[model samples]
Target: MPLYAPSPALRGRQLAADVGLLAWLVLWVVVARTVHGAVLALAGPGRAVEDLGASVAGSMSSAAQAAADVPVVGDELAAPFEALGSAGGSVGGAGQAAQDAVGTLATVLAVVLVVLPVGWLLLRWLPWRLGWVRDAGVARRLATADPALLAARALATAPLTRLAALPPGTAEAWRAGDPTATRALAAVELARLGLPADTLGRDERRLGLR
Candidate 1:
């Protein structure tokens, strides 16, 4: 019985998700490491943190004094005045953190977008060129002055050509991962052609196959 399989779209989606997750994880690691390194550079070993407590306390006192000067205001106004400075500082810190996070994320995303297609292009071109070069080598090897030898070579190579010419299958064994079925089919074809069966044992050992 044939195995059940997911559609190409579903497989593509899964691949996309996996790639995205991997990208995100890599970005996070980079950001974290960068931040840690930056912090270490700024505050080396034996360095002390600058004290902000005195400045904050002074600002709170000033605010409280300003609130006290406001006419007709009760003691309740002092509480909000005291809290205002801390609240503003908290808001500023939160905003800065958000900005930093966004900047880091943008950089990561831009890098991914830029590098992805270049990587794909390299992958595409390298294999295509290699295949062309390989086939050229095969042609060179099959180059013979004798007409009978050429005809024999052609006949022997026909099965491999047929196998290469097979319409890419729709089955699970062909679409995403497993290639055993396609390979088996190719082997059957080679066997049918009665290709130098004694010289070759494995499917890969066949001439011009690798």
Candidate 2:
């Protein structure tokens, strides 16, 4: 037997879901890279400078230890210790600097993880609610929809390219799906959008789309 395929509606919905996931993943990657770069830059003089300072301090301590073990240069090693002690004065400053850098990284990551999704949702939902503000830059013909119909449009979020030339009412009924009123409203809407009246069935037409 041949494998069964989903209907066009099911396939379209799945494709939409996949696109949303891909967009979110791309956003997260960009955010992560940005946060990492900021933390590194704010570390001031970068990781290389901090590592160099630590290496120099460690080498000086090792040299002093060697000198003291040899007995003859014990006083010379004491001099080296004083020099190291002076260098260590900036240790606290470096730590504070690193802490501040890390804090900024945390803040940025928090915004990307927490705030960005909320913002995307608002942008996604809000325009559909308020018709005047939605992005309608494209010259595509949109269904002249009331608020509920508009809400359904936003919820569906179909790609403009994939949308078939639907009778607006049938599309709205499919979206809203109130069995009591759906067929009736769909009939009127189909007539309004110039679709065939038979599309909603004879029983639906007899029952006024109240």
Candidate 3:
């Protein structure tokens, strides 16, 4: 059996849905970007640990330099103190590096935990939504439509090149339990563009639509 073609009102509703979804996405992207900035600021730049390392090394070196300036016993003490200063410096440097690493890790974590999931959702929805956008663009004429207009759309999407390529008019024939050529052609086109899958008998009672 031939498929149902939705009325123009239904088509309009779908077009609006596609457009609304796009607007929704624009809002979502703004939210995502704002959240990203917030996360980055909260995470910080890893400088505090680095500064602590530098401070510890500097203090130990200062003590060593003062102690090393004295006499024979001072010479031995000075060497040990110098070694201690070097160790402290190493510790400080390690702390700085560790903080740097932590900052890097936090950045990765934020992207994965926050942005990636949102990105994934956008990836999933956008393609389907874009398809609707394209379909709507092609079927825009359906907003102010007719049998001929719908038929024109059907031909645009499908492989059917000529009306002669399809079965004869179904609307005229449908009453006698057959379909008309005009509806048959339009239906095929609408089907290609993904329309009219659900139709009502005519509380839809309007003209120029299914």
Q: What is the C-alpha lDDT of each candidate?
A: 0.46, 0.49, 0.57
Query: Would you estimate the TM-scores of all the predictions?
Result: 0.32, 0.39, 0.50
Question: Which tens-of-lDDT digit does each residue in 1-210 have in candidate 3?
Answer: 212124566556556655765676576566655655665554344455556657766877787788877777777777776777777777667666766666666566645655565566667666765666576454544533444556555555667455456655543443343324445665666655556523212322254243
Candidate 1: clashing pairs of residues: none
The regions of model 3 sitting more than 4 angstroms off are 1-55, 72-74, 137-210
Best by TM-score: 3
Ranking by lDDT: 3, 2, 1
What is the number of residue pairs that collide in model 3? 13
Residue 111 displacement (Å), model 1: 2.0
Name the TM-score of candidate 3: 0.50
TM-score of 2: 0.39
The window of 10 residues in a row where model 3 has the poorest summed lDDT is 197-206
Query: Highest lDDT, which number?
Result: 3
Name the lDDT of candidate 2.
0.49
Which RMSD does model 3 reach against the true structure?
Answer: 10.1
In model 1, which runs have C-alpha deviations exceeding 4 angstroms?
1-80, 133-210
> What is the lDDT, from 0 to 100, of the residue 11 in candidate 3?
58
CA error at residue 86 for candidate 1, angstroms? 1.4
Candidate 2 per-residue lDDT, tens place, 54-150, comes to 6667767776676778777787766776588457535634755676777677677856764677567657644543332222211012222232343
Model 3: lDDT of residue 171: 35
